[model samples]
Target: MSISASPKSRLLITHVLDFNSIFLFKAQVSRQSLGVLRDMKAAIYPITRPTIGRKKIPFRPYNTFPSGLKAEVVTFDE
Candidate 1:
């Protein structure tokens, strides 16, 4: 499952959170997709924090998506 941001871009949902009637989902996307989401004012956040030994690595949300890859969405049953 995917949401089309444009004729050439798409967001693949990887995780889903359901709260009563509202749904929150996660996606691994490209910088282009990130920009699109930002333009749409979607709530964009880093999915994880990286740490090396005692130092916390800086988080860059755009790095989450691997290069040359697309994503898929997940559906759940109530």
Candidate 2:
């Protein structure tokens, strides 16, 4: 997937399948990118509930850094 703010700025994403069967995603920012891409700061929110009939859903803050990547596996019991 590729996300772009303009013709010169873009975030390129590539997916790789490892030998362990885990999917790894890699992202690269173009050299001419500006703003958020240049700063490399992003907020990610994971939805824990269904939003079918909800008017508002709380956002859980997840921080991302340029130094490294973090991955989490969550399981819910019904």
lDDT of each: 0.32, 0.27
lDDT of 1 by residue, 1-78 (tens): 455432222233232452212222333344554565567554364432211111112223446533313222223111
Worst 10 residues of 1 by lDDT: 50-59
In angstroms, how far off is 56's CA in candidate 2?
36
- Cα lDDT tens digits, model 2, 1-78, are 446332222122333532222222223333334344445453133222221211111122323322222322111111
Show pairs that collide, candidate 1.
none
Which candidate should be chosen as best, given TM-score against the real structure?
Answer: 2
Off by over 4 Å in 2: 1-20, 36-78
RMSD (CA, Å), each prediction: 17.3, 17.8
